[model samples]
Target chain A: MSTAAIAALTAILLVGIASTVIGIVGHRARRTSDFLVASRNVGAGANAGAISGEYLSAASFLGIAGLVLSDGVDALWYPVGFTAGYLSLLLFVAAPLRRSGAYTVPDFAEVRLRSRGLRLVCTAFVLVIGWLYLLPQLQGAGLTVATVTGLPAWTGELGAGIVIVLSVMFGGMRSATFVQAFQYWLKLTAVTLPVIVALVYFLGSGHTYDRPAPPSFPERTTVDVHTGVTLQAGQDVTFTAAGRIDGRDVAPTEPQTWTAGSRHVVGEGTDLTFPAGSAVPVVAGGPVADDEWLLPLSGADPHQLLGIYSLIIATFLGTMGLPHVLVRFYTNPDGRAARRSAVYVLAMIGVFYLLVTLLGALSRFYTPQLLVGGQTDAAVLLLPTAVLGSGTAGAVLGGIVAAGAWAAFLSTSSGLVVSLAGVLSTDVLRGKRLSNFRFATVLAGAAPVALALGVTQLDFTETVALAFAVAASTFCPLLVLGVWWRGLTAKGAIAGVLAGGILAAGAVGVSLAGIAGTGVLGVLLYRPAIVSVPVAFATMIVVSVLTARERPTDVDAVMLRLHAPERLGLSRDAVSGRDRAELDEPAPDERAAGPA
Target chain B: MSTIEERRADTGTVYERVQAGPEFADLRRRLRRFVFPMSAAFLVWYLAYVLLASYAPEFMATKVAGNINVGIVVGLLQFVSTFAITTVYVRFANRHIDPAAERIRQQIEGPAR
Candidate 1:
């Protein structure tokens, strides 16, 4: 069969498997309880695996690989931050969150604050983060499909979106748990198998591939800029004079080369064609100063500081607020189970990161030709082919990379769609009604698809990073404060969620309108997580302190419930689905022990 | 003070009436205060990791892992330490926490009398 046929077959088979599992689970799930938290019966190992599967997504698996490949050594932090974010989840929020007896974050807000308004605000934040996260999963699917079959990107996105909607809308968390758990292993196999095969292929080639040597620095002359518009004085901006790589002038091909003085031409009349693989050393002639390390952070030029910050904030905090990630914890039998799952997730993620770094380093050395378009995202896909040469060996390797991409999109999208479906039923539909749940799932799938199609042209990693920054800004603070601080009030949560969510949303909205890079602060604040997260945490603390009187009177009791282990049985009834109404009235002896 | 003591006597009678051992009742008081804050501390430490990663990348960029960098090492440690912490928690639960909780549960339920 052709590659398209094979991929289509695989897609159908996987979706069929997911649908069957959901069908079995969904039939028995008649109540709101089943749809929200899977009746709280999942075991530790399975939950951990599912969480890992969900959390890995396109971002963790492919995005990290892509990042490490392009950004040299600094990119390793992406996976580190992604994994470590869970430690924060485990240490502070897991047990208390479980004990709260709330299905979603909004439920916790409403119940804790006794305010519908607070619930609505939180619901809005969840929707924004969920949508932002989902967009990349779709984009990933599109890219993967395009890579594999030479088909349109929309074909893969639409195919994956349709599958997710059908399965999740009908199935809910009970279904999502099984599929996500299975996908983790599939993803691992998909990624690791190709690398192993490629390694073998590399060996068979007699270990004699011509590895491109690093550019020699001593012979190359660079031009130093004595006068330029200084963002920070004393920080030298050295432009490279016209130079040759393989006997061709490399400077005209890379305007950002040490060749251009303080300025490069932009807009219609400017020269555009540049040699794709040419590397320009940005800070080559200077003693690089403070914050000079983050030159790509500037939105004014992709070469500025804010650009780097944007990428960092998105990747670092995005791990925390991912829907699929949070939902993975729900599959754990208890809070402790959730915490342990996160632990295992970290280990698994750490190992893959090692390989990612190697792949990145190899790409930098061997495949300078591929970097010509600055299509760093395509490095991992192209690496295998580049190594194997354009033969069946290359096709097989490319196919494997393509499969990995598909897994990233499918796994992450399913997790996100499931979470969105649940939120839609709970928040948008105002109850966990089954029909509403189905509608929410469709909306979840369709909205992202529409957004993906509308913005078919975008930098995949950059767009996804923006989503992460927004997520970190919004939910990270909310989940952290909600679980740990007893003084956290409904108003504070609402304020923080709004402050962070709105700021990030506003940044995204403005960027979409092409208002980015207009000014320095505009560039700095373009990736709002740097500003928004602090604002969020501060908003929560300030509002919470001011509204201390309205803080839950049973905060102490709730804290006890959250802290007490499942072994303690204080909150066992909560996890075991023994509703408060069914809980036997405590005898005097037991009553003396606690109000929790 | 007299009225409070009287109220306690009545409540104490109810405990006996329900057949809950005094030990079960006492466990609730002891365990709540101990576990609540302790767990909360861990959660705070975990959140700090998120805050540091999200808000403090400059600090993370410092080298630690031989081009792996400080941010990468610390972030990766979050995953490694999570499993370590969970293992510690599970062991802690099984050895001391779970057994105490189970004992209380049994005592309160009292084998259906």
Candidate 2:
């Protein structure tokens, strides 16, 4: 086996073992409260670590660098949008939602709106968004494992799925909090150390950073293609090929020159040698010159104003709505701790994103071959070896990165699955027993793994962004208006959620099916948040105004509970205590008043 | 205190009275004072950055220093601004919002020790 592969295998194994051990060690959850919300006793710093850990999915760890490497400065919007989402959370949703004392988004919806139907609607969207988010993490695991070990993609997906399901099923939220917190530090060390090493080495070598165009090979470079790739070259050139090119097989012992400015097909299991100073043939998308790459929003196609706006809107508003992220806020002891944890999350996520962006920019110089192979996602994994020349240090760094990637997949997928299980067992399956939770965990974790095995073509970050867009459209309005506005009727919420969820989810569906043509329709469908979010908010407001009489009788009490801090010596504890008692009894009318 | 507890036990009256009381009002005002304006300003600043990046490409690409263009600086500042906002809000909340809220809580739930 290759040294890098061995290192990656070791990393994956260590991550899996460490997470499972942590899950077992922290397995003290004996009640529903422990399983669902960690008994709401987590402190600020640890919860912050767990929050950042789960929030930085494969999309942030691997996809950001890949996006930056391929798309250039415009891609920086993703990291910015991601981190700033927490700022929005800290300012608006964090404390209020925690004060509401809901375990899941659906719990919040039902508790605040006093409607079973809205809860059901929220449950469905939570499942959809959770599964949508889970798909990419699964696919990314498959891709990472394949890149490192040359194994079939499904093996990695299956491995990550099993590890996540086992740990989550064992301890649920209580264990997940500790596991995710550990993962935060693991991922930080994983990405940051190698990047610092690479940067110092790069600077010490006195490499030129002033290149005015798309990256070219700094010297003779050989790229091995594990899968077939179609590439477009910008200029005529000659190179050595020891594999199949353009459906014609070339003997390994023989070398051939190829013409540029035309499409060339490199078959699986081929090696292509490129001379120094030659432009890397663009794959996966069109060729981008260096000048366009360095400029914001000017790469290749140049007119993505609408797309950029859509991304900004989706991410800025979407963070508060993610099921995994929201559930963490429930682990905080009080509303104040929720807010404090968010502050810590902002710092943690911001620092991590800064490091990943640096890695992305550096990959352009070190791993341009990833662009050629249409495997930019591997840039983070392959960068160490690329820069340090495949020695012991490079293998160790690659191993650490591999471990980080595994941590990303495990932490995120486990969070999503646990939240999904909480909602499913509590709401849909009507199962309060721990065994039922385990069954729901398997069900929740299995669907995404199955879907991921079949759907491998979607870009990880883009798919995750779609999930965010859906959340932004559906839940952002729900939480914001639910917390701040009292005129929100259950009927209006129902209508708004339906309108927004359907529109945005339909856009995602159409985009996924590849039915939206590459025109205005496609752009709109690919990023429906700009239109869908407004439509939802307006629907909610107009409908609420029209149906004001349909507002819940308990709206005033719920508002007081949400906005009033726990320290405010109000009836919050009395209400919460009563709510908990009502929950234990489980009467139909009292169920809505119980802790969700 | 017993009367207060009894009043609070009467379904919604305790919260309603607290909501109308000076401490709760001060708490609400303090929280809203920070969150509302801060959210608006941040959103506007963020949107401006996005708009500039999308619509004003050349201006964003203009070099600010050696090898550091306007876009890079602005992107870095986005991170800086997030940290700055977080630090400022944390400090502000500790001093302004937390105290008011704590006072209200004391009025209702009594002292923490």
Who wins the lDDT comparison?
2
Q: Cα lDDT of all candidates, in order?
A: 0.58, 0.82
Q: After superposition, which runs of candidate 1 have C-alpha atoms over 4 Å from their true positions?
A: A1-32, A197-320, A456-461, A512-514, A518-523, A567-596, B1-113
- Output per-candidate TM-scores for chain A, rounded to 2 decimals: 0.76, 0.91
Per residue, candidate 1 scores C-alpha lDDT tens digits across B7-95 of: 44454443343234455445444544545565566456545654665567677656543334555555445556545655665565556
Provide chain B's TM-score, model 2: 0.78
Q: Provide the TM-score, chain A, model 1.
A: 0.76
Model 2 alpha-carbon drift over 4 Å, by segment: A218-235, A240-273, A284-287, A514-516, A568-596, B1-8, B20-26, B54-56, B64-66, B106-113
Clash pairs detected, candidate 2: A213-A290, A214-A290, A567-B105, A568-B105, A569-B105, A569-B108, A569-B109
Residue-pair clashes per candidate, as listed? 22, 7
Predicted model 1 interface RMSD = 9.3
**Which candidate number would show the highest DockQ if scored against the true structure?**
2
